[model samples]
Target: MALKITWRNILPGCFKAKSPTSPLEPRNQVSKTNSLQRLSLSDISNNGSFFSASDISNSLIGFGSNLHIFTLKELEMITQNFSSTNYLGEGGFGPVHKGFIDDKIRRGLEAQPVAVKLLDLDGSQGHKEWLAEVIFLGQLRHPHLVKLIGYCCEDEHRLLVYEYMARGNLENQLFRRYSITLPWLTRLKVAIGAAKGLAFLHGEEKPVIYRDFKASNILLDSDYTAKLSDFGLAKDGPEGDDTHVTTRVMGTRGYAAPEYIMTGHLTSKSDVYSFGVVLLELLTGRRTMDKNRPSREQSLVEWGRPLLKDPQKLDRIMDPRLEGQYSMEGARKAAVLAYQCLSHHPKSRPTMSNVVKALEPLLDLNDILAGSFIYMAPTEGKKDNDDVDIIGNEHEETEAEKNEHRNVSEEEEAEKKEHGRHQHRKGYRHKHRMRSFRSRAVYSDTALYRTYRTSFDNPKLQGQDIVN
Candidate 1:
């Protein structure tokens, strides 16, 4: 007997199986109202967040739920057949791909370009992730959020389609060497945009909660504007003022809220905490968390929180690349807002709208302050200060500062190159010795064989065959 394997068993990561009905197919059992009665929103919210076979018979938004869906050919055609050259970026879930769909030809498409995310089938549990993203992004629409184009479910292949962001993600722009230096204003705008997106999610009618909000999840467009991306960890915020939504906790380690980490309960304030971490990254140009830092200073939120409180110490936290270009007032306000979000008590944190209000003035404040920062900064011996630790290594030399203070020249680069070459040669020798071990093993085997053969042939052969 031939074994029958359903698509669900074969496909590892898809959230749901598509129905038999197509975009053109007749509504058979799928349109039945009797099954619709069982498909309550409460059922969806309480259990699996998945539709049952009976629920599949009912309509979801406008489409039938049980569609077997995408043909291998259609997916291949959409993603250029999963070409390596079209690959965009890889993540914990899978590789993202850049593809061009002639939206002009598709039935429901408004005629625009679309990007596709094909879940890596090897080791990812991305079907659930894919479902969460589609369900959330498809239903939620906000100016600050990226739009989900559609999805494809066929055979074992699962993919998500999204409107392309030209500038990739915010992490790439902030720290990537190749990325253009985002002016102070652009950074502020991106922060505000991201804030708005989070606010919308937290304050929605049913209040959807974005469980994973990080710099990498924030995508940028052609104009360098920001849009919130990635909703794989999202959940519908508790209905009827339950105060907090609880679930099996899932999120990146550093960006997760402390309370959520201890208890599985999640809330809008959890997102607010993560948002504060992103804001710190924007201001200081440092990662949210780094293990390499001394144990006392590892987590950015913990380390930076103290400095954020004192305006006098804010300069130590500013990105050195900005070179005194940002408004001290704007920077201080940002610092205070970040501190509020990082509060030990989630209730103490302000709403996303409050964050937006704090960041809005900085949109134009960068140029308005301009070179005027020389005057805006409090001069030495100013009495407006309180107990401040002076923040950061104020006495230590900044890279640029050291160059000017010590009068270092081009010779430094040449000296460093020579030192690197010496280290490279040492590494090469170690590698060569490791590779030569096989050859030595073969020679040793030959010698052992010769000795063994001689020993069998003659009792006196051992001493004659031996070599140093």
Candidate 2:
């Protein structure tokens, strides 16, 4: 019988992280290679078998037969029995791990580097999330979507494995301390790729509802190509001509659409709203909600939503790292697209497909405005989601509170700028001397990839040292 997760799977909220109770050591434990070259296809594929849709899909009617299936023991072994050292990151659903299966087995099975996710054994919440991910990734297929190889359901264990992405997540690249500076062109490509993925999910034939679409969930491959991941909060929309899909409210605080938050009515436009916030992050290089910012400015969506409506303010919103390298036309078009996504009314926003069309020509640096075709007229005098106060729950800050918040943010920004300058100098030094550092020592070894530990020493390290 197929396994399923439910509220009963979740442990009490008081559960704590603990060491694994395994007698066997991990397969390997090598240090990481910082600047590795891509593995050849032959290296990636030693065996004839590999993951595909047919492997996991149900055999009848070709509904979901292409999917791959993984045994629980295989996942445990690949992830060193889910060792804490192999952890990649975590989310509302569970922690992610970086691990490898045997090259011969993978090639024979046609699998590539895979990430494993182990669900927490809490209760109803865990079950719902598990079901959500299975229902969506089990069936959805798109170039921009992350591929799920297989899953494990053994006793209390519930895990899912996916193709590994080297560049990490869009959120890390955009907002984290270890994030790299993305060029304007790359940022635009990511946006376009992400939009296309969402369009596929919300396409006419089988409209899948992605309840949580944010920067963090958008993982990047080594080449910096974006792939949408994490579907634990996803939902399939109601069928037919129904305008909206409604359910219990579930989303990140800053990215949730105003209408959805207020009315509990969801639509593909809800994802569009979150995408707008992500675009703002790409353009401004800011977090959607940062405690380090002044209270009034803590919410990036609240601060930048108004500015997005005006094309002239686009320059200020664009990431300064681009150093004015982006074409004005390109920035303007992006601003307009962002404005549409941020539309207060769900009906007023352009469909995800339409958003993809608007971005198609912008991909080329040369022909940004050459393909500018306006499909929808801008709505005038529209009421914004923040304009209405539905709950009437008043949480006011005294003048003292406001002053304290402002002071804290000012100090934080000062530190960030100071750190930025230091990093810039260090990077310059690295680039100049990097030629001499290129050796087999900098490359990935067969045994190294399988045995690397993902642990972070918390006590002596600062926040910036956590990921690297």
What is the clash tally of candidate 2? 28
TM-score of 2: 0.65
Give the distance in Å from residue 134's predicted Cα in candidate 1 to where it truly belongs: 1.8
Cα lDDT tens digits, model 2, 83-103, are 887778776666788778764
Stretches of candidate 1 off by over 4 Å are 1-42, 45-70, 103-105, 366-468
Worst 10 residues of 1 by lDDT: 458-467
In terms of lDDT, model 1 sits at 0.63
TM-score of each: 0.67, 0.65
Clash pairs for candidate 1: 13-127, 14-127, 18-66, 18-67, 18-68, 19-66, 19-67
Error of 2 at 185 (Å): 0.6
Candidate 1 Cα deviation (angstroms), residue 279: 0.4
